[model samples]
Target chain A: MEWRWDFTIEILPRMLSAMLNTLLAAGIGYTIALVVGLIFLLGQRTKFRLCNWIVRECVEFIRSTPLIVQLFFVYFVAPQFGLVLSAWVSAMLTIGLHYGTYLSEVYRGGLEAIPRGQWEACRALNLSPARTYFRVLIPQALPASLPGMGNYLVGIFKDTPMLSTIGVVELMHTANALGAETYRYLEPYTMVGFMFLIISLPTAAWLRKFERYVGRSMGITK
Target chain B: MSTQNHPLELPEGSPLVRFSGVTKRYGDLTVLDNLDLDVGAHEMVSVIGPSGSGKTTVLRMLMTLEKIDEGVIYVDGKPLSHMERNGQLEFANEKYLRTQRTNIGMVFQQFNLFPHMTALENCIEAPINVLGMKRDEAEERALNLLDMVGMLEKKDQHPTRLSGGQQQRVAIARALAMRPKVMLLDEVTSALDPEVIGEVLNVIRALNSEHKLTMLMVTHQMGFAREISDRVCFFYEGKIAEQGTPDQIFNDPQNERTKQFLSAVLDAN
Candidate 1:
């Protein structure tokens, strides 16, 4: 296929507009994952043996399964069970659940990175368990978790293209639509790749800078 | 065990801290076995032992950091590990433990100051939140404590900014802000550089002589233990093998284990 400058120009605006839905999907999906990850984290932290085992197994199950399979199951399979969800809802739920499991591990590592001495110090101070976790432990955990958390932010963004398979009108979906209508595959597909590359590279850089800033702000010298 | 005679005499008025038949185990490995000890009001008691001798566990159990596997600990004449419900003994709940635990303060070997907070903030945190002291009052108390530990200039610095001895000093200050009746020092100087050990020890000596706070220290510094402690204990195999005045335990160790352990420690030094 010949490169067409005019054709690429004609399609740039449409692709740019589609990037909005892409960002929206990633933002909402990441927010959901962040909240859902905490719920799973609490499940892992709870003392009840049965509840902990069940949540742990569920997290493992979601993490082990591919995101695409989860998306298809939620989008295509739920209707037969009389629980129909919109394409956006299904894609969001799937992305959230899949990434939420991964994020929970990030949270777990962060929590574990804190020394056992910190908890004993809190106990020595006679702080309540709730106050101890919230006031002392979580703040310490965030500095350690920020890099992993930021990686997954970019990760969720990169993975948003998978939502196109389930008919979400994100960047890839719009690119596919333009290709089907115009009978030209080169420009839209290349633009999608170029756009993603530009966005992901800068974001990953900013996140690295952000990670150091968080560490410094938390008074972690190393 | 060299010193077999348990010389802990619980004075007429209820002693400040008492451990009776307290036992702790990790899986099948018993860390403390039927340990019985006492600290009178404003008394200075030091514990010295071989590595696995349950000395640190004594401080840990008093801090409520470890669960007692058997027997009961008493603080200010109240059962600590268990509660009486309808004349039946039951494991004490977290609420009961928290209420009972406020009287004790602990300084760890690691100087486990909260890294994210300023020294002043670390001192003020629990008093304001747990004690419900007004922020101004808490800060005032905290500043005074910081001044006492000779760390007033470093109050705004995070713990990471301080050296090991400095951090321990601030830890002592932080513990004092709670106004605990008893302080448990678990090798607080073990992590310090040799030169800085003097500063940390000086702060501790000041605390011992100037204040009436009952102290239970598990230390390896035989000289400091002799100088400061009213009584010194030698623990062997999860039990108090010997205990008495520092002179008795050091110069006239009663048990074979105590004599052998002291000689080994002296050789190392």
Candidate 2:
């Protein structure tokens, strides 16, 4: 089948709206993942043996399982258990939890990269626990954490297509619908691929700049 | 989450810091074994020993950096590592630990200044946040301390921008901002370049002669310790082998181990 420029132009508005939905899904999911990642990171840091073990196991389980399976379970099986969330809600929760485990590992790696001397220094200064983590430690952790966090941000954006199987009207879902209705698969699928490229490329570049700025502000050259 | 106690907080004339029958073990290797030591009010004592002799562990325990496996540490007449629990001592609660930690400050071998903060920020953070001092007051006192350490001009520089000696001076100023009654110097000059050791030693010398601070240091610089320490203790295998005024410990050593260690150390220098 020949590629149809006219058909592509005709469906451009719908695809644009679907692009917005994709961004919204990625944005909201990333926000949830950022917060949930911190919660998971704190869980890993706690001293309670059972709690630490439980949280560690949970993170491992999430990271090991496929995101699509989690999406299916959240969208399909959860309703049987009486938690009947919308497709968007289920997808967001699954993506947040799945990527959140990855992000927690990033945070753990960043924290471990800090020298033991920093902790001893905080003890020596007699800084409170809250002050030590927030003011002193986290600022240093950010420079080390930014690259991994940026990687997962892009990872989550790419994985938003998995939401389509659960029937959320994001870019890929919109493209599939357009293809089925017009009996033409090429233009819609190709447009979707180009749109993702247009967005992801600039985001990766911007994240690099952001990482450098964060490092510079934290007195970490290179 | 346990109720706390301060059994060592007796009112009458207790030592400023004491480790009573303290023991530290790492797996099966004992680091500090049944250690007993005392620092009186406003005294300067230097601990000298070869590596792994537990000189650094002594200061680290007093600073509450290391846990005591078998005994109690007293600071400012109160329990430091343990609290009295129904007539028995247990690992201290956080409230007790924090209360004791405020009485002590430490300088590290690596001069671990907060790299993200300027020297002035490093000095004032504890004063304003931990001590709840007003910002202007904290800044004022921080500046004076920077000036005293001869780091006043570089107060705005981050630690990464400073030389090792300059950073150590700033670290000293930072510790002084806490107003700690006891200061621990754990090989403070050991990490510096040989040329810059004199600058850091000069700051410490001024701190010893000019301030009434109770200072305990673990040092390899035998000459500096002999010159500045009021009392010198030679440690061997986690215990003090000999202790006395500098003249007695250095010139008239009695313990054979002390003699051997000093001769080996002095010959190396």
Candidate 3:
């Protein structure tokens, strides 16, 4: 089919509104990922053997299962269990849990990146364990982990389209509804693809800039 | 200056630094088995040995950086690590340990300087934080230490920017910033280039003569150890195979281990 100017012009405003909804969902999903990732990371580092094992198993299970299945499970199973959640809430939780597992590994890798001698030096100076982690370990670990964390940020952004499968009225969902009513698939789908490119490309670039800035500030790069 | 007030005294027969039947084990391997050692006040003792002879372990144990599987270590007539009158094993009161450790400072083989901090900041960090000294006082003392080590000009540079020898010198000054009576040096010059090693060795020799800091060093540099050390302890297979003046140990060579190590190192050089 040939491109139709009138059809594209007519649908432009509606598609823009859907784009806003998609951006909002992505922002919420990322915030949840940021917070839930820390919780999962702490669970992995906890002293309790059973809790650590259980948390690891849960993270691995969630990670191994497809995000689409997770979304469907949260959306369909929760109502049966008498704990109904809004489509938006279900999508956010699923996305958070999905990405949190990866971020925990990032945190662990960063914590281990610090040389053993740094810890021994702290012990030699008799710094308390609390002081050792906060003053020496975290400061060094956080910077080394920044690049990994930034990669996950981009990954989370790309995964936002999966929310559409669960009736979350995000970009793809709105595009589907518009196409069903108008009998026009190409315009909305193409517009959704363009909107995603607009958002993700700049975000990836900004994260790259941010990673360099963090490295320079931490003195890991000259 | 304050050395006169310190008096440099060991109470009667008590050792200023003592390792009483200390044993260190890593899994099934016994690194230091029932080893005992004593360092008198104002004495520079050098531990000489072949590889894996447990010379570094002795220094690490004295610095309280390594745990002894058996027996106790005493410093200045007090147990360096033990329970209080409550009669329970503890993680060791960190604050008390910090204070006690101020008397003993250690320089690592790799120099292990804080890479993020400047050379002056590295020297001043422990004094200000661990010793609770005023920032101005610590800065002043650090500058004096930088001058002593001949690194005052490069005080603002990061450790990575300096040569390995310069970094070791900065580390030595950082350790001495605490005015420690007993200093531990673990192969500090081994990582340095041959051309740069002399500058570090000369600095250490000057510090020993000028400040009379009681030094315990684990070194493979037989010539430097023989020249600077008053008493040399030859360690082999986790035990002190021979102990005597540098002249007796190097020239007379009482133990086969020392003789073998000397010949190997000398032939390599």
Candidate 4:
């Protein structure tokens, strides 16, 4: 269980390679979450009552249930339906769908934070609904929503280790494999935790700074 | 004798705005019920009343921010919120509605200026984008408007940095930028401090005197309303209980509601 400098140094290159895969997975998952969140937001805003209700229920169900269960279901249940996806695809799809629900609420909150008078002002100006949303609403709403969205990005980054469960050789899986081969849990596991803290801490700090910058610009500074 | 023989023509000045049997409701709750009212063209008409009297609703319904459960609103003899083809009420197309909104501009209790935009940018936004004026032209007009409001120096500042009075002035400039035929004021001064209220009211009074913009204001500031408004309407419980000139309503009140309202406002030290 004692830390060994030579062994840690020897495996550091392999761990760094796996770190690249982990970062890539987080990037893809975050991208999918961003786009899918907008889709769900649009679904909730649609006029049809049934569509709205169904989307609401589905989003609520997804939001309430555990992401691990959802991931397992997608990874396991799909093969029974005569379809198969690579572990990376399954992980991305699950993470995206899971976080999409939370992000949709963030989008909704941002939209609602806008005063009713803003919409009336747009109407008074005779802007079309499309222009109103794009030029006025979205510009304000996106900045208001960014902090929440940034938090989710960090959440997705931390959750990338879950990808290792489905056989994706991300940081956690690489640590596990290295530990088994070297018969040393302390070095690889501790190194994996350090790698996460190193990447995520600065990213979280950057997101906070970004949120402050946007808040100042939007006049919503705390 | 020659002048008499030639026949003198009387200048035509009557009600330019007419609300006919207008009713507003939220489900079973009636906010404005079966109301009829009128104001002469280029006249400043103030609606004064207690809370829930539908004074604000009158302005809101005119702006088409609220739908009428019944009745019609006409501006320069054109129907609002409905279409008339061959003298029949038909579903108006959105294009028609869009054109209709341009004829009327409104100011609210809240300044409602786009917070992210500078005062000049807020003034010019609608003209360039919605009215499709060239950007330079819009900016020029917006500058002129800010100059009129005496906020030309502060045009580059955002709304949050400006005082409540300045924000309201910018909002007034924004509303006037459209060059609307009818301007609706919904307690524009209520949110400002007493000292700042004078500045906003001064801008409005000047606009009324200089340009003759037809104005309908819902207000609680009885002194300002009395000094500026040509006529006053007493709205009580979703109806116009009485309406007349400021002299008639204030000096020689006829309706009990108007008497009670004036007494209350005057009595407040």
Candidate 5:
């Protein structure tokens, strides 16, 4: 199949417009993931053993299963149980929960990286547990968490293509429709790949700079 | 200062801090075995011992960082690890511990200054957050404490930027900012290099001579302990092998374990 300039130029506008849907899905999905990750992290940290175990196993089950399976289950299986969800809603929910488990582990690792001495210092200073966790521990954990958080940001963006399988009108879905209509896969698929590359590369770079900025601002670095 | 509000009646002339038959066990190994210790008001006591002799545990227990397996700790004449409920003692909850713990502050061997905060912020954080002091007032008191520790110039610098001795001085100042009635120094100088040890010890000496604060120190520096401590406790195998005025314990040393430990320690120097 020849790479045709005319065909590529013809489809550029549609692909670019579709990119907005992809960005929106990834952005909203990541926000949900961040909040859900905190909830999972709190569940794991709470004093209740049974709650911790249940949340932990749920996280593990979500993580171990395929993301596509989860997306299908939420979108296709829920309507049978009288809980109908739109493709966009199902995609966001599945993406949020699936990546949330990963992000919780990132948070757990970041928290564990803090030395035992810091907790003791908080205790000696008589800081309330809420103040200790929110003011002291979380800020310190952010620097350690930034890199893993950044990786997942890109991970979620790449994973948005999976939303196309559920008929979400995001970048990949639009590309697939264009290919089916035109009887040409080359232009749309290549454009989708280029669009993703263009966004992901700079995002990864920006995240690196952000991680350094957080570290320097927090005084973890000179 | 809230000591007056607690309803528990104190015995007349009772020490400010008392550890009555406190025992701490980690699995099968006993870190402190039926330990009885007391620190009178405005008194400075130094605990000296070999590694695993429970000297640091003495300070840790007083700070309520470790739960005692048996017996009770009293701070400001009220139970620290327990509460008076219906005229009987019950294990204190977090609320009770927080209120009672305000009277005591601890400085660790590792310094443990909040790395994200500057010297002044570290000192003021607990005061403003926990004690509900105004920011300006907390800053004023923290600056004074920084000045007292000779860390006034480094008030704006984070702990990573400061030397071990400087961080420790800041740690001491941070603890003192709370106006604690009793200060627990757990090998405060052990983490410093020999050259910087004097500077921290000098600040501690100033605290001993000039302030009326009660202090309990766990130290390996026999000479410095002898110079500043009103009483020196020699710990061995989770018990006080000997305790007396610094002169008596360091010079006349009656216990065989004390003599052996002292000789070994002095010979090293």
Candidate 6:
């Protein structure tokens, strides 16, 4: 119930080390999500109706359900089907997939924001589909996508605590262990909150600056 | 898709672009109905009509931006929307469209210059990326085109920073950088301010006289069209009501629709 500086100082090293795992998990998870989101977008864009339908429904299903339930299913249920995965792998896969659906929507919105005339211009100029998408469309989409993508970066970082449920031994897991061992929850939990606040605040500010920089570099904004 | 056993029968001394019985429908509305038209090499044809009269659709179809429900569009005397396979015509595939679309370029009403690029970059993008030209060559060609359009001073400016007319000039230069055999101008001046309209029209005039570029323009500028067009087409109800030399179409008009349209348009001025 009372604040304790001594205990906080005693647990600082373990907390800092655990924060590294948390950062690593978020970084790897976000990378996977970014790539997975593109694949999902492609799936929805493919010519095959069945494939589009299946990917669309999968995106919806994943999005409609809770992330913790999904984490449980991937961590607990897969082993039952003789597809056992380690805690780190299962946590990474679950986080990637859960957030990927959201990122795909972000990408779709970014793409749709482009004027139809741009595509027409590309076609009239006879640029190949690959060039149009990669060179023209993606650069334009990136500025539009950056804000949403940045939000999810923070979102995934906050969600790293969910990885603790699967025994990934990240920040939240360390906090819980320290609290149980010392029978003093206040310092450990408070330190965890401060740590998250410390990182998230600066990240959000930096992301805004980054978004503007991207827009300016692309000549989309003056 | 239309299956023709025989090869396309082009007219005598075939035109650079031929729209042969091309039909386009949007649900129940036929936007272009059984249309037949031609543009000879170095010819400038101006199409004028009220909105929904399918004037823009002509340019759109020639640019392969819209697919015809029936018939074929020939560019450089080859089918644009369809291909001949095994001596039979079938709907053209994407690969075929890519190869054939290189011969054409278009300037849009809204300019459609890539906002992410500067005027020079916009002009050079297609030449470098699509035509596989070396960067220096593409830049040189783009610089020359930007100069021709009177946008050389603003070549480093983005489309957003430029005025509407300047953006349009950049768009024109962008199209010409491809060195297209035919240029489609779909009301390219419609989006400009009244004062800026003259600058764009002046650019087009120079293009007509100096470059002699084969052009198909859909426009509302009756006077400008009358002055420069080698042939003027008056469209009504998805067909050309009348077409003739600018002198005949503007000064000694024939068709009732043409008379009504010209008078209504001229009266507004």
Give the distance in Å from residue B49's predicted Cα in candidate 5 to where it truly belongs: 0.3
Candidate 1 residue-wise lDDT, A1-222, digit = tens: 799999999999999998999999999999999989989998977879899999999999999999999999998998999989999999889888888999999999999999999999999999987899888998899988888999999999999989999999889999999999999999999999999999999998998898888778878755
Top candidate when judged by DockQ against the true structure: 6
Candidate 2 lDDT by residue in tens digits, A36-118: 99889889877688998999999999989999989999999999999999998898898889998999899889988999999
User: Tens digit of lDDT per residue, candidate 1, span B1-269?
Assistant: 21112222334587888887778899999999988888998999999999998999999999988888877777787777777676555667888998988899999999999998999999999999999999999999999999999999999999889999999999999999998989999999999999999999999999999986799999999999999999998899999999999999999998999999889989999
* Interface RMSD, in order shown: 1.1, 1.4, 1.9, 1.7, 0.8, 0.9
Where does model 5 exceed 4 Å of error? B1-9
Off by over 4 Å in 3: A46-51, A72-90, B1-13, B84-103, B124-129, B133-137, B178-181
RMSD of each: 3.5, 2.5, 5.4, 6.2, 3.0, 1.5
What lDDT score is found at residue B160 in candidate 5?
Answer: 86
Residues B167-260 of candidate 5: C-alpha lDDT, one tens digit per residue = 9999999999999999999999988999999999999999989996799999999899999999999999999999999999998999999999
Global Cα lDDT for candidate 3: 0.81
* DockQ of candidate 1 compared with the true complex: 0.78
| CA displacement after TM-score superposition, residue A145 of candidate 4 (Å) | 3.1
State every prediction's TM-score relative to the real structure: 0.95, 0.96, 0.86, 0.92, 0.97, 0.97
Fnat for model 5 comes to 0.69
Q: For residue B67, give model 6's deviation from the true position in Å.
A: 0.8
Q: With candidate 4 superimposed using the best TM-score fit, by how many Å does residue B115's alpha carbon deviate from the native?
A: 1.1
- Model 6 off-target regions past 4 Å? B1-6, B9-12
- Model 1's CAPRI class is medium
DockQ, in order, for the candidates? 0.78, 0.64, 0.40, 0.47, 0.80, 0.83
lDDT of each: 0.90, 0.90, 0.81, 0.86, 0.92, 0.91
TM-score, structure 3 vs. true: 0.86
In terms of lDDT, model 4 sits at 0.86
